[model samples]
Target chain A: MTQASSPPAVSIRNVAKSFGKGIYAFRVLDDVSLDIGRREFFTLLGPSGCGKTTLLRLIAGFETADSGAISIEGEDVTARPPFHRPVNTVFQSYALFPHLTVEQNVAFALEEQGMARDAIRKRVGEALEMMRMGSFAKRKPAELSGGQQQRVALARALAPRPRVLLLDEPLSALDLKLRKEMQIELKMLQEEAGITFLFVTHDQEEALTLSDRVAVMQSGRILQMGPPREIYETPTHRFVADFIGDINLLDGEALPGGGVRLEGGTVLSAPHNASGKVTVAIRPERARLAPAGEGALEATVVHSAYLGTAMLHKLDLPGGGTFLLRQSDPTEAAPEAGSRVGLALPAEALRVLDR
Target chain B: MSAALRRFFLLSPALAVILFLIGVPLCLMAWVSLLDKGGTSGVDWSSAPSSANYVRLAWEEDFDGTMILNTSYLVIFLRSVSLAAVTTVLSLAFGLPVALWMASLSRTGRDIMLLLITIPFWTNLLVRNYAWLIILREDGWVSRFVNMISPWPVQLLYNDAAVAIGLTYSLLPFTILPLYTVFEKFDWRLLEAAHDLGATRKRALLRVVLPIATPGIVAGALLVFIPCLGAFVTPALLGGGKTLMLGNIIQMQFGASRNWPFGATLAVVLLAIMLVVMTAMALWRNRRTA
Candidate 1:
C-alpha cells in the first residue's frame, strides 16, 4: 500500500530546554525548529550529547519546551503531556516490561485503551506476526535475544497505530551484522505502517541509509538539514562534512579570485568563493595519488592501511600538513613508506568554508 | 597437605559447627515430638514411638481447637494479618510516593530522607513497642487530648485494637524499606515509554509500576506477616493477656504450665506452619519466575 500523504505530522517552533535553577541550571536545547512530514522517515544525526534525543523527546511531548510552541496535525500541543500525544517511542534499551510476556507487552497499549478482549487478541497476534515473533509470544523479554527484544519493542509501539513513531538510537545495542539487517526491516515496517518516523541516532550510516531527510545537529542546534545526497555532497560547515563522512581539511587562505592558497604556497581553484581564513575539505575518495614531481604538491608516504576493499595512505606534505588518500587496489605498485608522492585534488571536489 | 585433604580440612570447622549448633537440636526435637507425655513423673524416654501427641492435640486436649477458635486468639491472628497487610499497603501507598519524591530529589535531599527513614531502626524494638503503649493508653497524653475534644472518651489501650496498632506501627518501617528499595531504582524511562504508547498516568501506574513492584510487595508482606504471627511483647503488654496469641500460649505452656513436652510440640507445630507458609511462598515465586 502507498503511504498516505497528509499535513505535517509534527511542527516544533523555537524550542529551548533548561534544567535546574540559577547557577546550577544548564541549557540543553536552544531555539530548535523542525517540521516532520506525515508518513516520512526523518532522522536527527549528531554526535553524542548533541541534544538530538532531547529534540525527539520534545516532539513526542515527553519534555515541554521552556519557550515555544509544538503543534501536531495543525493543533497546538505545546502544553500537552506525552499520554495525550499521538506518538510512540521505541527506546534504545527497548524498555520492555521484564515481568510481562511478549504478548502481554505487545497488548499493553490496547489494554490501556480498554479495548475488547477478542480485539486485543487479534491485534496482538497480528503485531506478533508482523514482527515475526509469533513463536516467542509466551516468552518474557529476558528470554529473547537483543534483536528479538528490539523487534518486540517495535511491535509493542506499532500495535497502537500512533500517527508518529519516535525511535531513539534503536539499533545502537545490536552487533554490526544484526544492526544492518534490522535497519532494513525497520525501514520496511515504517513503509508498511505508513507512519511518520523521527529517528535519533549518532550513526551517520544509519541516517543516510534510512531517513528521507537528515538533520545534522551540534551542541543543541541544527547545523544542516537536507536529503542524504545533498548533505554528503554539499555541506555548509566543516563540522557537518567531517561528521557525516571522513574528509581531509587543509588550512588555506582565500585568494583574490575564487581560489584558495594552501599553506604550502600552492594555489588551487575552488568551486565556491573563499572568504577570510578558510578551510578546504575534500573527501578521501576525491583526492588522487600520483608519483612525486608529477602533481601540484610533493609529499612522502608516511603510512598505509589495508582495509580489504580499499587501501588508505597517509602522506606527509612538504609544508608538514598530512593528507589521507584512499585507493581501491592495494596490489597495485603503490608508493611505499619513505617514498615521495604527488597529490591531485579536483576543484569540483574541494568545498571552501569560512572559519 | 594434599589438595583434597587440605580442602577437607578447610571445610571441617564449618561442618562441625553445623552439626553441633543445628543438627543436634533438630534431632532432639524430632525425638521429642514422638515421645509420650509423662504426667507428673518425668524422664519416660523408653516410651514407644507413637502419634499420641498429635492425636491428643486433635481429640483429648481442646487446647488446639480452643487456641484456633478463641475469639480473642482468632481476633489477634486476624488482626495481626490485617494489620500487617494494611500497614504494608499503607506503607506502599505512602512510602512509594515518598521514595519517588526522594528518588527525584537531588543527591543531598535523597540522603537526608533516607537517613530520616533509617532513624527509627536505631531504637530498641521493646522501647519502640512501649513507646506506642504510652502514647495510645487511656490516660496517656494522646488519649487525654482526644477525650478533651470529644464528647465520649476513646480507650485505645489493653485491647486487640491496641495490639493491631502496635503491630502495624512496629512493621511500618519494614514495609517501607523494601518498597523504597524497589521504587528508588525504578527506571523512569519505562513510564515514559508507556505514556508515549498512549497510557494515561493512572493506567501506566496500574499496568507498569504495580506489576514490577509485586516482588517488593510480597517481600514486605512476609516481613510483616511472619514476625507478627509469633509477636509477643506487643500482644502481652498492649493485649493485656486478654487477647492471647499463639506466641503467648506457647510462652504460657513453657513458662507457667510446666509442660515442656507440650510446649516443644506446640513450638514444632508453629515451626511447621511457618515452614509451610514459606515453602508455599517460595514455590509461588519460583513459578512466577519460570
Candidate 2:
C-alpha cells in the first residue's frame, strides 16, 4: 500500500554496541545491520532487554556503536552528536517539556535550528493540527491527559521533519482503547509524512499492525525480517513464530524429498526441502478440527474458550503434547471439553524452523 | 488518640520551642523598644515611655521645630543589604554548578562531596573568621602573594571585599543545600529529550535544566540572602573596624552604646524586612503552583 523500493533512509552496517566495561561488559547489539527504506514504516519487535531500544538509540546517535558504521541518507553519522543528526525520537514516557506550552514544545526544534519566528509558528500550528491538538496549544503538558501528552510528543518529534523518526514504545503508556486508536493513527501519519519510521516495540500486535516490514529480534540479534503477513505465517525462526503469535511447536524429523515424519508415525508434506530434525510450527487459526477417522492427529479437547468470533480449543495430541486450535465458525457447536477429536494441519500452514 | 490530636501531639515539641525560645524573646524585645533609655546599661521600664528611639531611626527632632533626617543608620542598612545581595549572587554562581555536578555524580561520590561540604560546619565560625583574619591581614600570606605582584601590600583585609569573601564562605552551605535538593528531583531524561529535539548542550541547559531547577534556585537564594543580611561576626572580625554593616551597628547600640530601645527597634526593622520577603516569595510560589 505504500512505497517499498525507495533508497534507504538509514543504513546500519554491522553495528555492535555494549554496556558496562571489561569483566562486566555485555554486548547489547551484536553485529546488527538493517536498511530502512525511505517512506517505509519499519518496526523492531522484541522482548525487553532484547536490544531493540539500543539499536534505535544508536541510530539517533544518542549512543555510539562500538564498531561498524551507521549512515543516514548516504552520509556517515555514527560519530555525530544527536543534534547534528537529522533524526528525532518519541520516547516511551512522552517526554514533553513540563514548563512549556504545547506550541512551544513543538516549536523547540525549529527555534533551535534558528528558523524564522513566523515559519516556526506556522510549522508548529500545522503539526498540532495533524495531531488534532490545535486547541491544546496553550496547555502545559502537566495540564493534559496522558494520551494528549503523547500526541504532543509526536507532534514535537515530527515538527522537525527529520529524515527518520525513531519511536521507542510511544503508545505503551496508553490504555488499550487509546493504544489501538493511536496504532492506526500513527501508521496513517507515517504514510502521510512520507518519512522513514524506525519504531521499536515489544508488543507483537503493535508491530504487526503498524509496520510495513517487521524485524523480530531476541537477545542481541535479529532473528528474522519480513512483511507482517510473511513473518506471521512463514516465520524463519522458532522464536519469531512463537513471539509473533500463538503457535503450536511440534518436534519432527525431516525425511528425504520434502517430507516430515512427526512423532506417532504421522507423515506430512514439508515446506522446506532440507532433510534434518526440525521444529514444526502451526498457527492456531490455521489448524482445524476434523472427524476422528479422517485427520492427521487424534486429540482430546482439554480446554475451550469462546472468543466471540472464534472458539479456541486446547487440544491434547496423541503424542502427549497439546496444541491450540481456533474454530472461526460460530454456528457449529464446539466439541465439549475432554472429548476426543482429530486435528487437520495442512502442509502449507506448517513451518519447520531451521535456524 | 484521634488522628487530629495525634498530629497535634507530634507537632507540640516544635511549637513549644518556637513559642518560648523565639516568641518570648521577641515580645521582650518589643517591650524594651517601647521603654525609655537608661543611659548606657538597659532600658528603664519604670520611666515614662517615649517614641524617641524609633524616631531617631529616620529623624532627629529639635526642640525648636527644626527636623533633620539622620541618614547614617539608613546608609548602614543599605550597605548591609547590598553586601548580602552580592554574597547571595556569588554563592549562587559558585554553588549552583557544584550542586548540579553533585546531582550528576554517583551516589557514593555525592555522599562524599556532601561530607566535604559538612566538614567545615563542624569547625566554629568564629575560629574560621579568625583564621581568615590571619591569612588575609597585612604581612600575612595573602599580603605577601599580593606584594609579589605589586610593589606594596594591598589593603585587602577589613574591606567590603574581605567581608564579602567571609560571608560567602560562611553561607555557601545554605546556598548549596536547597539547590542540591532541587537538583535531586530534576529528571536528567529531559536533557536527552532536548538533545533529541535538535537542541545543543548549551541550549538544553538554558531551556530545560535551568527552568526545572528554578524552585531550588529561589530556595537557595532566600537561604543565603537572609542570613547574610544579618551577618555580624564575619564582618566584625574581617572589617578591622573600618566597615560598619547593620549587624555591627545593632551590636554597638546594645553592647557598647547601651541604647537598648534603639537596638530593639533596629532588630524589629530587620525582622519585618525578613518576614515581608519570605511572605512575598511564598505567595509568588503558591500562585505559580496553583
Candidate 3:
C-alpha cells in the first residue's frame, strides 16, 4: 500500500494501434489508458485476442501506438525501439537461444552494453543463482526441460534489471503442476526484485494470484481495473463478473428503496439502488446451499460435483434459472442430488450490475 | 528375425541399387587406374597391373631422368577447389537473405516463388548455357551495357568471372531450398528476444539468426560446392577453351587423349580429396553440435 505513492512506473494514455494499412486495417488496441505504480504486479487479464498482449507489447516498444503517449518513469518511450527502452519481455515461447548456454543468454544484455567483463561475469552468476539455475549455466536451452527453460528466460530478462518487466503469457506453455509452482515462484520473485511487472495472461486464477491490480480487457477495451477482490466481488461490467469466475446472473430491476426486485417480485436488499434495469451477479461460493424453505431463493438440487476441495451443487431456481453453490466444508448434512434445497444469496455478496 | 537383420532385409533393394549403380562402377574405375598404357594398340592389360598412371602424376619417367613436380595438374585441382569454394560462398551470400525473405512471405507467395525456381529447370542445361553465351557475347546486351560505362565492349564470355557467375546462378536454388526449409520452422521471436536483450538488429542477425541457421548454411554450401567442383557444361561453354578446370581436362583425357587409366587416376584422386574434406566437415559439424 505504501508503494502506491512511489509514482507511476508506467503510464499509457489514449494508446491506439492497428495492423495492416488503408482498408484492410484492423484495430488491435483501442484507446487504452492505465497507470501502473512502482513495484506493483499489474496484470492485463482477458480471453484471447483481447489486446492484452498487444498492449503489453506497446509498452515494451515492440509496437508503436497510432496515437497516444507512453511514459516510463516520466520519460516518453513511444518512439523508442525495444533495445532503447528500459524494459524487457519474457516472450510466450521463452525465446532462449538454442545455441547459447544459459550463462551467455543471461549475460547478453549487459554484454551488448559493453560492460566490464568482470562485472558481467559476476552479474550473470548472480542472476543464475537467483533463479537457482547456477548448475545449469553451461547447458543449452534444448537440453533443459520446459520449466527450466522458463526459469532461464526469467533469469535472462531479470538479469538486465530493467525498471519494468513485461511478461506475455510466459507460463502458458507449462503443465498444470509446473504452472502452479511457477506462479508462486514468479510472484515471490517479483516482490524480491522490487521491479514493476506487467504480466499478460488469460488465466483468471493466475491473474488473481500474482497481480496487485488487474485490468480486465475485452475486445481492445478495458472493462474494469481494480484489485482482485473488488474486481471479483463488485464487477462493474457483466463481462468481468462472468469472466473472472462462474457467476449466477439474475435479471432484476433496481427498486427505489435500496434493493433489487427480481422478475417474480423477490426484493433483495443491497448497498445501492441503481435506477432502471440491472443484473444481480452472485458468486457461486457466496451463494450457499441451505435447508428447504429457509433461504432467500427456494430451489431443487439438480446435480452436484465433487471437486476434491469443494463440492459444487447446481440448484434449479423456482422461477426459471439455475444457481450454482460451492460448499468448501463438506461436513454438513449435504443435500441429495435430487433433493429440495434453497440458495442463501447474501445482500452484501449480491452485486448489482447495470445493463 | 532380429531388428537389425530385419532392417537390413527391408533396405536390401535400395542397397542393391546403389551397389550396382555406384559401387560397381567405382571399383571398375579403381581397377582401370592400375592398368599400364599401351603404344597406340590399347591399354596393355596382358602385361600386369601397374601403378604407372598414378606415379606419372607426380614423378614422370622422362628420358632426361628429371622428376619435376607435376604443378600443372596440381594447379588445375586447386583451381577447381577454389572455384567451388567461391561458388558456394556466392550462392550462400545471395541465397540466405532470399530464403529468409521467402520464409517471411505468405504460404501462397512462397509457393509461387518455389514454382518460379522450378521454372528455370524446365529448360535444358545445354540450352541455358548457350543462352548465356549469346547474352554475354560482344555487341550483345551485356556488352552494350559495358560499353556505356567504359567506352569499350569488355570481354565477359571466356574467363573465371563468367564461369563463377554461371555456377552461382545454377546452384543458387539448391542453396536457397534447404535454407528456406530451415527458416520455415524457425521461431522468429528469438530475434525479438535478442532485441529485448539490447542487441541491435545487426548483432541479432549475426549472433542469433546466423548461428541458428548454421545447419542450413552447411547443407546449402555442400549442395553448391559438390556440383560446382565437377561442373562440366558451365565451364566448357563459358571458358571458351581457355580457362580449363579439372572437368574439361578429365573430359579431354577420356574423349580426345584416350588415356583411360590416367583419367581414372584423376577421378580417383578427386574422389579421395572430396572424401577427406567431407569427413573433416562431418567431424567439425559433430563437434559444433556437441
Against the unseen true structure, what C-alpha lDDT does each candidate score?
A: 0.83, 0.89, 0.89
Candidate that scores best on TM-score: 3
Q: Which of candidates 2 and 3 is the stronger one according to DockQ?
A: 3
Model 3 local distance difference test score:
0.89
In TM-score terms, candidate 1 sits at 0.88
Candidate 2: Cα lDDT at A180: 95
Comparing 1 and 3 by DockQ, which wins?
3
Question: Could you give candidate 1's per-residue lDDT for residues B1-290 as a string of tens digits?
Answer: 89999998999999899999999997777677677656663324778876665654544436554423225434544554564455556555665676567777777987888888889889988898889878987778899998999898688888877887787777766777787778878888889888987788888888888788878777877787777777888889888877776678768766777665665676677677678777998999899777
Task: Please give the ranking of all candidate structures by DockQ, highest first, separated by commas.
Answer: 3, 2, 1
User: Ten consecutive residues with minimal summed lDDT in candidate 2 chain A?
Assistant: A1-10
Residue B75 of model 1 has an lDDT of 55
**Model 1 Cα lDDT, one tens digit per residue, A1-355:** 1134654787889999987899998888889998888888999999998999988888788887899888887788889898888788899999998889999999998988889999999999999999999999999999999999999999999998988889999999999999999999989998999888989999999999998999999988999998899899989998998898888888889987688888879887886665778889988888998777776668899999999888999888888878888987877777789998888888888899877
Q: Which stretches of candidate 1 lie over 4 Å from their true place?
A: A1-6, A290-296, A304-311, A328-341, B1-118, B148-151
Per-residue C-alpha lDDT of model 2 across residues A239-352, encoded as one tens digit per residue: 898888898988888887777788778887767776677888898989889987777788998999988898989988888898999899866888988888988888888788
Please list all clashing residue pairs in model 3, or write none if there are none.
none
